[model samples]
Structure formats: structure tokens, C-alpha cells
Target: MPPDPADDREAGTVFLPKFDDRGLLTAIAVDAKNSEILMVAFMNEDALAATRASGAAHFWSRSRQSLWKKGETSGNILRVREILVDCDQDALILRCDPAGPACHTGARSCFYRRLEGEALVRVKT
Candidate 1:
């Protein structure tokens, strides 16, 4: 059964995520201490549950069609401190303390560049 529209969900204590037609929700990871965005990924039901259970950031790999824990291979795990859901329950923000660079390219954040005019420019760290 679904949650009550008026008494639950956005205004209530129950956590009812609204996954998209693809059965995935957007998850954004941010630095817990500095509030810098680390990465953005997708999460399925299993990934969400794993993250909550392990206190680590887990995501659904859209390309690989599998579940993966952040930093599983690179030792750059994201230790999640808190998960904040959007009012509509379709998106989540994970505040985390990252063990190392969040990007596969070894950048501190996946978002290391900005659009300048028609080109991408690396943001000065």
C-alpha cells in the first residue's frame, strides 16, 4: 500500500521514495564538512537499502546495470553521515566524509569543470 497523500510522505514521518519509471532515484553526494558536491549518481531500492544499512554510499551503475559501493575499488569510499530526501521524495542528498578523490579521474569532485561560453573550463582548486 502507498502512503497517505495528506498524512504521510512529504509531511509525515514515513519514508516513501518516488522512483522514476526506470526504478531509480537521483542521489547526490556532498562533502559533509564543507558542503562541496562530490558526485551524482543513481540509486535503486537495493542501493538505497545498502547505503542505509552500511553507512556507506552505494549507487546503481546505470551503464554496468549493477549495484556498486562508492570507493569499492579505489579506496575512496564515501562514508555517509546523513541522507536528506527532497520534499517530493524523488531525489536525495547524501552528506558524506569521503576517504579520497570522488572521481574516477582522481579529482576531489566529479564536478571539476564549468561551462564557459562554449567550452568547459576546469575550476581552480
Candidate 2:
């Protein structure tokens, strides 16, 4: 039998997320003003809760195996304006206002490269 609707959807209007095997949900950040995709990351329960509490973007670093606050090192903080979860609740889209570049490469977004035929091209600002 399938799970109850409450377990899958309605749930009395409360938000319920379906995390992956790693207890992480995919998070996509976009620029609130321009709708430009900023970056993609993962959020564990702790990271999600922290982001909700602080109104800032928090992520689980698979490389560091730790919780990370966006812009902790570079001061390019992402202030979350809104968050929308996927229908199945396994992923989230965060609309945010960024203080500076979102990419570690000093680009406005991590998606600064585009595929041109078979070659990767850097998008000119």
C-alpha cells in the first residue's frame, strides 16, 4: 500500500522534506533580482534548520563533511529571500540576495561556463 497523503503531501500544511540516503536535500540558489542561478549545494537537517533560523544560506560540505555557512571565508554571504521545495520535497530552490560573487572563482555565479558545441566557454560579463 502507498503511504498516507499526510506522509507524502498535505501534512496539515506543514513543510516536510524527503532527504536522500545521506540525509541531505539538494539546494539550488538563485539571484533574487535577476533569477540567475548562483550555485548548487546540499543541506542536511542541521544545515536546513540553521538556514531557517538565520535567514542565511547554510550547506553541508561533502568535501569537508561539515556544516558550512555561505560566505564564511570570502564574505560573499547569500541572504535567503525565499525557499521553494520540489513537489516530492527532495530538493529546494532558494532565492537569495548575494553580497558578492557566488563562485569561489570570483564570478557572480558558479555557472559562468557554458558548453559551446563540445568545448566549454567562459561567459563574458
Q: Over the stretch 16-96, how does candidate 2's per-residue lDDT look in tens digits?
A: 888899899999999999899999999999999999999999999999999999999999999999998887788999999
How does candidate 1 score on lDDT?
0.95
Q: Which stretches of candidate 2 lie over 4 Å from their true place?
A: 1-3, 6-12
User: Over all chains combined, what TM-score does candidate 1 have?
Assistant: 0.94
Error of 1 at 119 (Å): 0.8
| Tens-place lDDT digits, model 1, residues 54-98 | 999999999999999999999999999999999989999999999
My TM-score estimates for the predictions, one after another, are: 0.94, 0.91
* Global lDDT scores for all candidate models: 0.95, 0.93
